[model samples]
Target: MTKPTEIKALVFDVFGTVVDWRSGVAREAAAFLQRHAPHLDAFEFADIWRREYSPAMEEIRSGRRPYVRLDVLHRENLVKVLKRSGITGATDAEIDELNLAWHRLDPWPDSVPALNRLKRRFIIAPLSNGNIRLMVDMAKRAGLPWDAILGAEVVRAYKPSPQVYSETVDILGLAPAELCLVAAHNGDLAAARRLGLSTAFVVRPTEHGPDQKTDLNAQQAWDFVVDDLNELASQLDASID
Candidate 1:
């Protein structure tokens, strides 16, 4: 295990780890549905849209499709979501507006405070699958104190893909052992650990909603495991502000 003192930077998974994508997307979907498809379930719509995330990225990861920003994929998925819901009359403008929901996600209550604290001691940034614009928009709206954003767009690949982890560490000019991947998903940690990076699991049991069965706890003996980013900051001895 890499010593905690040797970990100079902390990179995070953004969607479910730093922000509550589920609730925020659902809220936006609810408002859009209220105007266009009031009969549909907003949460269900949000879930369906999120379900498409992995498969879409797999296209790029598997080299079946060239890399594109997440925004494009979200718009494409939004069209499918609307059609699946039997609402095909949405204008291109409305579809574009609705797709911005990913940018409007709200952070968990402890996110801002905890990230601010963590930033005091180490270089902190997002190693998310989200594209630059998406991450920038989210950070600005949510007061996330990312020193920089590094992820799929930078590497032209997605998480669990070795390059996404290795390239990011390369971009940071750090030895793999000098950086820690902080994420709520155990699979993400597993990916980083395999690449010789330190790993920290910050559990978010509600990320997939109340009935969420997966990723409810750390799946491995990660270097650090905590209930939330706040606990993670405490574990790292990053004092609260």
Candidate 2:
């Protein structure tokens, strides 16, 4: 393990790492569906919307499409989810409102407090695939104490992409060894580790749902592996108060 003293910044994977996108989206989706399509299942709707996330980003990754912010991909995916649910009469305003559900995601119980503690010790920010506005809205709503937001939109690429990791380290003006990537997903950590960044795997067993089978444990010997952010803070010796 790299000594904690060597890491000057801690960049995070936002969605599913710090926030509970599933429940938050479902909460908003339920209200929207009740008004627009009374027969749809809100949780199912949220799952459907999220299911489109990777393939949409892969289009840009493969050079089949130009890079666009995550909001655009989300809205396009929302349209598909709605259509799949047999909802053909929803107004544009309604769709847009439902789309903002991503911005309103609730943080996991430990996220805010742990982040504030961690912030006292190191620069903390999000290196997510989400756009700047999305991260801002989420941070404000969730009370996350991020020092800055840097990710796919900033780097014009998504996670697991080498540039996303390398460039974010560059933008922070730190060598890869000086920054740590904290995430729930193994692949995200693997990508960061490949680029010489330290990796922390924060377990989020229900990020997918109760039946989730992946990323339940560290798949590799990450620099740190803990159950949640607070534990990570404790390991890093960040004070609770």
**Model 1 misplaced regions, further than 4 Å:** 238-241
Q: lDDT per residue, candidate 2, 112-136, as tens digits?
A: 9999989988999999999999999
Q: Each candidate: what lDDT?
A: 0.91, 0.92
Q: Number of clashing residue pairs in every model? A: 0, 0
193 Cα displacement, candidate 2 (Å): 0.7
Give TM-scores for every candidate, taking all chains together and pairing residue i with residue i: 0.97, 0.97
Residues 1-241, model 1: lDDT tens digits? 6678888899999989999999999998888899888988888899999999999999988999999989999899888878887897788988899999999999999999999988989899999999999999999999999999899899988888999999998999999988999999999999999999999998888898999999988888998998888888887784223
Residue 211 of model 1 has an lDDT of 95
Error of 1 at 30 (Å): 1.1
